[model samples]
Target: MGLMALVTLGEWAAKVGRAETAVRNHLAAAPGFPAPKGTRPRTGKGTPYEEYDEAELDEFLKAWEAAHAPARYQVPGDPDEMRTLGAIAKLLGVDGKSVTQYRAAIDEHAAHEDRGARRYYRTGDVVEVLNSRKGFGVALDPTRDRRRTATASEPGS
Candidate 1:
């Protein structure tokens, strides 16, 4: 596989073009289906949030299809597609306003214009903000050069 993915039930269902219940209630109980590797507390109610390795799941599904169904799986690379700020926010589970502000403040990354000149960004850049912890509590001061050395007064200095 070209990417690392620990997918949830919804994602799994989407990958295999099956209903969530079909995957949960039927296929998951099948002998050849892959078992969930981990689980977290559900956000609302119902069953705990179970996660599966997308690569492994795809491999199993591919074989199953060859033996039983009419399809094959194509494991994708890390999601780097360009998307609007709103789309990025939706995908990354962040507030749309926060993404907009962060994007504007960064003043980098030339956006691709599509859908009558709407702006879009690479998914990796947006994901990097979340993973690198550079998007939160960022101070943008016009008076101070961002490259300046941190003073003793700054936090963690």
Candidate 2:
């Protein structure tokens, strides 16, 4: 997992849209689940948590997501796609300030710029950064009152 992203079990739970207990329960029966690569130390005051390889998690998720057409959050066309900070913010459904605050914390951090004077980052890098945070994984717009909750009517129901 050289320089790649490692996220805690909590983040994995968020990624799968399940509670941590659900994840723990599933793990017992699902040997295919990615094993924890290691643990990441807390920045402030908290117990360190089990960290798993993010790429492995993605691979596992892709297979499960196949039947659920049009995922709640669309994966980028290219994981290596270059995007500016504003674009990353939109992708994560977060304010620019929040992303900027965590930008430096991203693993293997680097900033690229084209002649247009805009800073760009790799899509994967941004995801790594977001997964490291305590309050990320779920893209909730703070200013919105209601999230999209209605599923499509079942084929002419």
Candidate 3:
């Protein structure tokens, strides 16, 4: 069989003949959007991605992308620097909890470290998640110079 009707963000963009950024922003702004499954208790932290049922992810994506609306302006890439979950979430057009799920799924491929009470992620890792999940073609070089290499693969670069 061919790819599923609702696959990547790019697929949704293609179906609606609009940019992926637009589709995401619209979903983010839509009323009554489903929040990410699983929550961290105030006393405890770290919700492993495995806590979510696979079907939940499918349902969310299907509903979110079904509209296929175009974006008003281009969504920019994450800055080539360390980013908090909120920053990454804004870039991905999802809530911060959803980003935690994505981070859990691809934790091995990207590097992250906890500083004090908050966990900080490399922008390269966030871009990798966007590229792999959204098919947005964001790139990050496997180099020591994180800042320089990360931006080297952004849209305009």
Best by lDDT: 2
Best by TM-score: 1
lDDT of 1 by residue, 35-139 (tens): 788875654665777788888788876665555531221212345677787877776555787667656443364334556767766666655544433211123
* Residue-level lDDT for 19 in candidate 2: 47
- TM-scores of all models? 0.38, 0.35, 0.34
Arranged by TM-score, best first:
1, 2, 3
The local distance difference test score of each candidate is 0.57, 0.58, 0.48
List the lowest-lDDT window of 10 residues for candidate 1. 69-78
Question: How would you encode candidate 2's per-residue C-alpha lDDT over 1-157 as one tens digit per residue?
Answer: 2787877766765566544554566552465788778876765766666688878887876654453332233335576888876787787677777667655554246445564776677777676656544332223332241432322221111
**For candidate 2, what is the TM-score?**
0.35
State the lDDT of candidate 3 residue by residue for 1-157, as single tens digits: 4432223433333443444454457553566544444422322354322122334435654665555422322234644567687877787676677657556544666667888987777776666565555322211231332322222211222
Residue pairs in collision within model 1:
none
TM-score of 1: 0.38
TM-score, candidate number 3: 0.34
